[model samples]
Target: MKLSRPLVLLAVGAVVALALLAGIAYIFKLPPFREKGEIKAGEVCSSLGSSSNAVDALTKVLPEESSYSFDENIDLRTDVTDTNFESSCFVAGGGKQLLVAKARLMEDESATSWTQWVKGTASNEVSIQSLTPFTAGDTAVSSSRFAAVFVPCTSAGKAPGGQYNLSVSTELKQEGNTNDAAARDELIKLAKNAASYAHVKAKCDMAPNLGGTS
Candidate 1:
């Protein structure tokens, strides 16, 4: 059968259009977005160590008259097992004692970071802070002292496609008894403890999720 040139061209055009449509459909049907990993509850506390030692260390550095209180628990959760936790403590006789901590985890091995501020305290409050992305031994501590407005997240990572974990801790002090060096030391020690605790919790929760196999 001899087909006219214009008719053959038209037929060729239709076939090309159909093929393009099929390709588009296949791309969309393949799930362009990967499913977010799942994070199970109760994973946050699986390997949390005792905070008592840290608290006791802080007590040694604080003034004899100063009183302290600590609270530790999971605060937020996502469907993918990414979690956040907070550990706070308050000191009396120096305004309101406040400590805050937070963390996040992902199923991917990629790095990530997040920052949060201390709440329920004075707008202008003294803060002591520390953070660890990998190990507690590999930490960065601040030298000079000053009032902080917001805590910042510098670096972060994620796992493959499973759950991830994170943690944050903070200690806040109000201006009082400037001559009491011991009080300041105690506050700083407490803040360090909070940070350490948060780091440990994050590692424990996200350990199983590493490599996304879990």
Candidate 2:
């Protein structure tokens, strides 16, 4: 039996409408398409979140007698992230050092999920030496004189999701004789201290092995 012309036209219209709806749904599912909140960026020398928190989380790990400078010498270049919070520090004395800390308030991220993000970020580097797992978070140390540690945390001691990444780079002065081994150890110390933040401890416990290059 031959279908009427009007009936065939009606069928085609229905198919077109369904396809358009599917496209819209897919767009909304992407990260960029979702609602975005304001991202705050500042260059304060001390304090983490507010004025009362006297301790400066970013520079707490540096060695004693090392003077802290705000955004004057360090350059993150292409590694900069557009997250909710970010801080950078440059320390001089024992050696010229650069440290960067970044945080994202993800509402739905697991240890496994954030681990992948960190690994993916490091995969493209020239050489990745180790990716060790620890109680607080996973640490990735590269022979390139750089280290990154990622710790899962909460936004404000309230659960949902929060994750942070701390990366440090060490550069010896032209006439200095410090070795990379000493600098690498210092970087690890910084990472451990950063993970001790109240917000990080609130969410991070004896985290399970999330498998990385280590």
- Candidate whose lDDT is highest: 2
Score every model by TM-score.
0.37, 0.37
lDDT of 2 by residue, 176-200 (tens): 2235555454444443443343233
Q: Which ten-residue region of model 1 has the weakest summed lDDT?
A: 143-152
- Per-prediction CA RMSD (Å): 24.3, 21.1
Clashes of each: 31, 0
How does model 1 fare in lDDT? 0.35
